[model samples]
Target: MFLNNDLGPTLEKIFNDSDSLKSLSIALGNASIQNAQIIMGTVEISNISDLHQFVQCTVNFTSLTVELDDGAWVCVGPCQKNPNFCNQQGACQNEINGPHCKCHSSYFEKYYGAQCELYSRGAGFYAVLFGCLVAFALLIIVSAVMIVVFYRAKRTSSKKFELFEDDFFDFTSRGGYGHQNFSVTEDSINTTATEVTDEQR
Candidate 1:
């Protein structure tokens, strides 16, 4: 049957005797007293042994209406006899939720269990930036090497330049000087012949 603070005195009477609270679920709400609340839920007793056996109870005293860690109302289960049990001071911490228990502040939850861990955000950005810089430097170095190789290849494959003196002078002078000399000689001869003929006549 669901039990609230209204039936508090009666529930205590049940707890006074050694009784097992099995298959029992409870919820507490802050009312009347600041930071204090009442639990309400039903207890199912299967056999006579259950009535005498004590089932664990969870109590929550939280200012936050909704818990950020578990997305449930914050509550603490009863102190467990197991040394590994989570609620040491009858206080439930955020990490373990309700099912498991956590150790000290240094510990974090893993799939298998909780272990000491170090928190670091430095590795992420540094790795990416370092990789980019290395790649860029390699690209620049390869490009420079390729450019040098191409320059050397082009210089080696080019045809040689040759200059001949005769060819250069012929191009600059246009006509041959020997042909002009021959024309001058012919003119002189013709003039002499005309002069001799006139004298003879």
Candidate 2:
């Protein structure tokens, strides 16, 4: 509907009211400019999301001018027509109609647009990875704490056993009523000697 030169001035009016267009592409054939030069290529646009944005694209002889960043773009593609197709945001796929941009997915971001120029970084993917790392760290910490506590408790038990052994053997050093120390005397030998002499005499 937009290709008709008869539609003419309605181009600005029709596109200026873009309310729901995410992407747009236009190719002009035998399109004439009244007094100005001619454009031989297509115009492509990756517009603002859910907002009205306008860009001007024009071609004069060999010099081409178009919106580079925001609005109307006079560049078109079929993959091989432009090496930097899809703005390098995605790989270009040549279809029967033209080139289609296949947006690539990443762990941290999702892409939009045929150029894949528009994107929103997602936290969910990175959040899950970060959460796993945190969980692993906590597990390591808990394991280390348990090992230290076990070794400390074992060392304390050994010290208690040593103290118990010392206390148990300490009783042998003190005298008790059940224990006695005796002395062997020389008088018994003297009595035996005297009896032997008397028997001999």
Candidate 3:
């Protein structure tokens, strides 16, 4: 049973053989399955900094007292109280030594501390970094392939154009089409002239 603020003598205790209850007095500051059996069966003395040895919720077997203040009892592990002692995003866990904070996600963002507050890097971060590097490498390779293909295609086209120019030569060059034989010989010209003179005579 957790006795909180009203650590007073207002309640009576009765023991019977027919129906009996036995209790042990021990100090625990954090919540646990074993401690949380009753009202989150954890007790804490909330004051620390001022060197104030006691708080309002102090209790003993014969009496109870409450001197309420800001530093009143709030349960933590045997030595702590504030659950957010483990940063806001972490869950406070009771360990044998003291309270520990477990991070919500270890893969994406690493958290480490007594309260799980400090971090360096996580596995997910490294994965993303690696993925980005691979993508960049692939992009460079593809660009290089495209450039090589374009250059080869351009070079091949230029060679084909040079061959076509050589085959055409030029209309006015030494091998022009007009230089080939396409008219009659001198013997035919003389025969025609003689026949004309005979007709005239």
After superposing candidate 3, which stretches have Cα over 4 Å from the reference?
1-83, 94-97, 171-201
lDDT of 2 at 76: 36
Judging by lDDT against the true structure, name the best candidate.
2
Candidate 1 lDDT by residue in tens digits, 1-201: 233234766755554443222212122332222222335566454443343234322534322122223433332332222434442322334332333434333122222223223233345457777999999999999999999999988876662323544565554365555324334588899999999999999
- Per-residue accuracy of model 3 over 1-201 as CA lDDT, tens digit each: 124444422222222221222332222333221222223334454545333344443323222323334755433242234646767767866654555677666777877776677877778889999999999999999999999999999999998888778447655566565346568989999999999999999
Candidate 2, poorest ten consecutive residues by summed lDDT: 18-27
Q: Candidate 1: deviation at residue 31, Å?
A: 37
For candidate 3, the per-residue lDDT at 68 reads: 33
Q: What's the TM-score of each model vs. the native?
A: 0.27, 0.38, 0.47
Q: Once superposed on the true structure, which residue ranges of model 2 sit more than 4 Å away at CA? A: 1-78, 93-100, 106-109, 118-124, 165-167, 172-201
Question: Per model, how many backbone clashes are there?
Answer: 9, 1, 6
lDDT agreement of model 3 with the native: 0.58
Of the candidates numbered 2 and 3, which has the greater lDDT value?
A: 2
As for model 2, its CA RMSD to the true structure in angstroms is 18.4
The TM-score that candidate 1 achieves is 0.27
Clashing pairs in 2: 55-72
In candidate 1, stretches whose alpha carbon ends up further than 4 angstroms from where it belongs are: 1-120, 159-201
